[model samples]
Target chain A: MPDTVATGPGPAPSGTALRELTFGEAIREALAEEMRRDPRVVLLGEDVAEAGTPFKVVKGLVEEFGKDRVVDTPISEAGFTGLAVGAAMTGLRPIVDIMFGDFLALIMDQVVNQAAKIHYMSGGKWKVPMVIRATMGATRRSAAQHSQSLHAWPSHVPGLKVAIPSTPYDAKGLLKAAIRDDNPIVFFEDKISYAKVKGPVPDEDYVIPLGVADIKREGRDITLVATSSMVQVALGAAAMLEEIGINAEVVDPRTTWPLDEKTLIESVRKTSRCIVVDEGYYRYGITGEIASVIAEGAFYDLDGPVRRIGARHVPVPFSPPLEDATVPTERDLFTMARQMCNK
Target chain B: MATAPNPATTGVEAGTPLRMYRQMIAIRLFEERVNDLYTRALMPGLAHLYIGEEAVAVGICEALRADDYITSTHRGHGHCLAKGAAPHLMFAELLGKEAGYCKGKGGSMHIADPATGNLGANAIVGGGAALATGAAYASKVLGQGRVAVCFFGEGALGQGVLYESMNLAQLWKLPVIYACENNLYNEYTHYSETTAGDPVARPAAFGLPAETVDGQDVRAVHAAASRMVERARRGDGPGFLLLNTYRFRGHHVGDIAREYYRPKHEEQHWMAERDPVALHAAWLVSEGLADQAMLDRIEKEVAAEMDAAVEFAQNAPYPDPQRVDEDVYA
Candidate 1:
């Protein structure tokens, strides 16, 4: 826990500089450490072993862990997800890799009805300790099918825990915590941030528990609550706002299900204005839920109605300019924050 | 793919057939009690009786060890009972009492008991297939030598996940068995109207050793199931068993007006000519395994046991409202 502060997002306040790792390397380190720690943990997905996924995040894992531990499954989402649920119930801790977050629709029944409810349905006799690692975010010209952030789907389910890590530091720690948790967790990684994002990670093991919020920056004028890829945009917008005299604080609620409402409400109460940014759709998505929580918890302390910014309702287009327009950008957050701050 | 083996070569002990006969009777009587509870409005929800298909569950379950796993279907009372579930608690669950296997959280359709390896009865048509296959995968990975049996009706053949699971099971050489109880009809409609091509060839295409047996014959079912179960225990991969049988009763207890889909003569013919319990009883008597008086004694004993179980369930208290949300998370 002591090293967590040193390796967390942003620069180290003190002590020696830690080695920097890309978002992909941090995730791979977390998986390798967990697998070495416990024999029960097994990884399975399409091309996960040899091909290392299209992102190359898990590229040398099969060689280190062997094909048995890092299994490459056929493209049967429902089948393997259900299999992971059963394997979790019986003994082994399974990590199911759903290549894209958009394919969650194909495995909803297995994840929601079976994996999520197995413990309650069995009257506490069984527990599913499994993690579903999926990729979210768009903008690589993959079009509508492969490019939607569907984290809101699992967030609405009762028994599932949803984790969305933004920084390489949080990615490693939070993924480690998710792997060791005793519940079914859906961990969504921002595909666009895999290689582009870099941050300090310790050589030792650490876990950032789910449901805790991290304040990326401190300010007094306004508070911006962001998640996953939006954290970087919110930080950029905050930096832009500081130049214009209005200071903005950025808070990331890393996990949506076990949401850190206390930190969000307290920050909003301190600043007296709030804006929620997420990569999912603007309508009936995670932004609305978090915004409502802050509105109810810090209603009396607010200076204005809590605003929400998220992905546009339109499907992510294949064209670069059109695709870029659908997602929230730094300028969108800056414009919204300036309007809220009356600057 | 091979045909069903000779029942005599099934390696069943001399007393096993008599025990199988008694188990079949117990299932028949248990279903009768369930029907009585439904008719009197004592039970809360739908009850799918395994009255005619008793041979399938008892036969397959008898071939399994207490530690081996079995995934059951919606009409799962017979499977649960054969797999060693306490009848009193099973009845209590049907009546929504606190003493049930799932503490009344899961009703007749979802009776799960970890002690006997009854993974749980899934209400969705083919929902438990992947769960069984997954358990087999775990067994293989952990070197546990445990085998899993998935029991489903012919209606499950329409579910795509079943095929997906089968493909994975065969591809991985998982130690699981697909026990398809083809009771002629899918709910009210015949399977021939819904299922295209030969059912046997389906698993054969996946390179599984597919076999079919008369589900009404307990010895025949036990014979084929034992071979498959042993093969799986030896890590020889998955097998498929198509159980050709009939559903003598309606789909559910409330489906009494089945004359719209099936005629009375067909029902009577199955009841009289192909009753599994009656056939097994007659075979037992003819084989000198037991006489008329002994069969009468067994029936009387099972009837009394069911009567007491129903009474216990009727008298048991319902689960407390405060504990409704207790098991939502671990």
Candidate 2:
């Protein structure tokens, strides 16, 4: 384990420190700091107020900003999302939370048909400065409906940016940036990352700009690319791969749509081998897009075929064991890396 | 038939008569040209023509200022023209050229010109209702004394977003006007077959003050819209108005073959008997406000204007394929 540091008052001379906070805590701090800095910032979601938010990401926002800014809405994703898009168009920065990512399927019209196309369709006369926050990943045995990572759908739409933060530091910085952005953003937070991962987040207002990739670990043998919760799994697999003399460079792209292809391609060029680990289904997933970009852009640098590790093409099962098998595990990533290294 | 009271004699002073007339004429010509282009295969994609629905757009837009906002529906050319969108740009959009509102990205169903305070025309049914409600909320927040008008169909009454938007508009007292163009049809299905009860009753049930207007009569629509706009400007929350009108054509340009849905007599009844443009023209001339020669001159001038628009659209360049990914984010 890396050296963990507490986030409070201390001689916090930061070099590289790992901090543990649940995903919910990281998102809450992000929203709080953003609201404190910008008066135009507001939040609306189902059970986001006195109910303390479904994921507790907006726990104390209602008390601090009052009900006007921190609104509790009826379970109407289409209506509220449309409202948020309108508010964003008129200069209000709204952060809306959908309880589960699965519910996005129901509100595709607002997100895809309206919010995504408003800016371009309006001939640049309007900007949808809004963020949609939702929890994804299988947990609590929530069954197939609630435990799907459907970020690919939004990723396919133009005029909408997507971000999936895996750590606390990323949660705070990315959320702040999304709130301040003048374009529509969809921020996906994995349910497992909410309580399992933590990092040192700055108390002051800060933003991690969109379209940047974070290098989790430096290595030369191979480059491992991942996003969201899969980023942590990639790092874990990298640690195990180091013992076998196969050093791996882990890259986590915080934003998915306007992807950091520059960093990814550059890393792949140096390593000559690449492996993309994702929790989404194999076909037409982020992994396919990333692999294609590398094959097309950096074909000369490749030593072998680029490997992709992702969830199998099957519905997320209710059983914990079956669900665990469905998602890409750290072990799966490690095996893929070893195979690429050996080749 | 009893003659209606002249709006000019009511001491209300109907807004700039010439400007209103020009807008109505512009909407009529724009729709007619679009219909012609569609038939000629010059325009691409489906278009829901606003030929007979010119009065609703003209009347509602006359009540709004340049800074006020309006959300439009799929049949939105009239709304776009009435709200001051350039006819050339609209024609270019229908032609799928780079000079279009969306730079050829969104064709007829989605045309927006925000410089004229016209929000993008929504392709989804009832989608604009909630957007207008939120825009009104933002207006209240900024203390901008602006009002938002949402143009939807009677078919949208079935959309849950409308009810949700109405409730929120009333709850927060947002300055929004929910304008329901009850054209009595949602595509092939009649509004009566889809809607459970009176459209006005839905909004009224949500505690919103509502009214029904003669959508065919431009003057009647203007009067009702003026009252609602004034009430919203005074911060009296939201209001709903149901315009009892009819679409003279099929839902879209290619929808004429789907005539099995409605009787031919019904279509002829609306087209020949209840044509809004013809009715308004008769009233204007019979009231001694305008002459036949003057009307001919106006029609000729509008025809020339539409011709220029069509020429510009045909000549406009296509967007650069390399820049396809541009503007995805600001």
Candidate 3:
């Protein structure tokens, strides 16, 4: 029932050829558009305004909106995150860039304790209207500290919402929705998918509401639940499965916290098999949560056990082969899907 | 350059000093009451007392209007009182009663009177620094002359966030004052153990017209805060003020074992020799601003007010247990 593209052949949006943007560009567009929409909106983080950050996602924003609105903070994660809390509590919509998801540990007190808990602790007297956007995932070989998927951290906490957008369309929509959201939200941008992932994102402003899942591919054999950049990997695995005559459906849960379990449950019920593919570590991770949801809801409907494909539990290595081995890829998803299909 | 107003003649009317004296007395007594309540086991959890640092809150708050903001620290009772928080409501919050400011949700550390411009009392050491920066940034962007005063301790300086926030505040010329209350300690460790270089020099690194004031002297704090507040109001820039003060009590209410950390004599020296309350009471009598009888009257009045607050908190109802699951999302 969602407006997301149900079946993907990679590119053809039927008759209408929509405007395109890379995932990172979509994020920048969302920031610029949101700032233009609301004067209270401001961007701050290390090199966010002056240098446009490492990914150049916030480029030209400072020139357009001026420095006062677009802030370039010193390299202090805890400080800037705390400022985000303060600014949001008083009167400002601050988009704080935590740089990398791994650096989340640095500002955990601000992000988890102060920002996430303020509204709840204040007995709903205060609303923390702030967005903490951090880059996540692996494959670029940024090494242990920089490359990691820690959306599970914020997702576990109450009084916070986590949005992990896989496509440019999802990126623009989810990020905008996150900015407009009254509660504190963490937007996780897949670093690998930033430039690599491209989709037709309409120029006109639209917010894909949080907690909705998008079915990227329609199939009958098995359901592949994916998040963020993992969506692409799942779709790729689905294509591989098609060669073997195993039709695999890929579902992208744009927002992790308020996960669209209804859509997932519906897909799993129809397919009767599920394999949750995640780039994050496997032990007690998102894959487990997704698999559990499927087992709990569509237990009897599942002919095959709900399998999970996730990165091994360890620090992401620097070597390309080791890193590839550490993070679960399309091949890993294919193996999991094949096993679920009894191939 | 705008001339700063003489505190005694201009901001002071016939009853302003007396009113401020009453406020100082109220904060001191309110903290003392919190100590007594926590000691009696009537109040659960920890309370960071504001016993010795009363002058900073009273002096700084007296110089600004109600619209001016303040971000408080763990030792926030004094700040809350000086910024016009109702003692009964504050007690209700501390008691976890439904009638509290945070509706029995936020206890001593998180007590906030948004209506009175007391943004919050942060439990995290340097958590409020950026908040005050953000609030001041809001004022600057809104084109409002309202200034935000951040009340932190010497320990908060060690927090990198404070430095980062200070840089942003200076860069944007935000209407915020980083009021550092150097209470000579960060938890059990002495400030000298954690702090490096100079506390004043830290903010001065950002080119803010930084100055250290005597935290014991109410008049001195008021005068300095008045200048900084004026400058900020006129769009000059942010000011960094470090108030040299000490705590007569432990870090929290239950941290009574003082001999394990600093010498008992050291606390005795601060409590007896450099007590802000005693100093201010003596200053009032000597300066002919108020005689002993007037000061006694103020004390008596504050005690009565504290008694009413305590009584009100005692009689207030507890929040419904069913309400615990609510207020998480909104």
The DockQ values of the predictions, listed in order, are: 0.69, 0.56, 0.59
Q: Is candidate 2 or candidate 3 better by lDDT?
A: 3
User: Which lDDT tens digits does candidate 3 get at residues A243-299?
Assistant: 999998889888888989999999999999898988778988888988998899999
Error of 1 at A295 (Å): 1.6
Ranking the candidates on lDDT from highest down gives: 1, 3, 2
Docking class of 2: medium
TM-scores of chain B, in order: 0.95, 0.94, 0.94
Docking class of 1: medium
Report model 2's TM-score to 2 decimal places. 0.90
What shift in Å separates residue B208 of candidate 3 from its native position after superposition?
A: 2.6
Tens-digit lDDT track for model 3 on B135-164? 888788878788999999898888888888
Q: Flag clash pairs in model 2.
A: A21-A198, A23-A194
Model 3 off-target regions past 4 Å? A1-17, B1-15
Please give the range of 10 consecutive residues that has the lowest summed lDDT in model 1 chain B: B1-10
Q: lDDT tens digits, residues B135-171, model 1?
A: 9999999999989999999999999889989999999
Q: Candidate 1: where are CA atoms >4 Å away?
A: A1-17, B1-15
Best by DockQ: 1
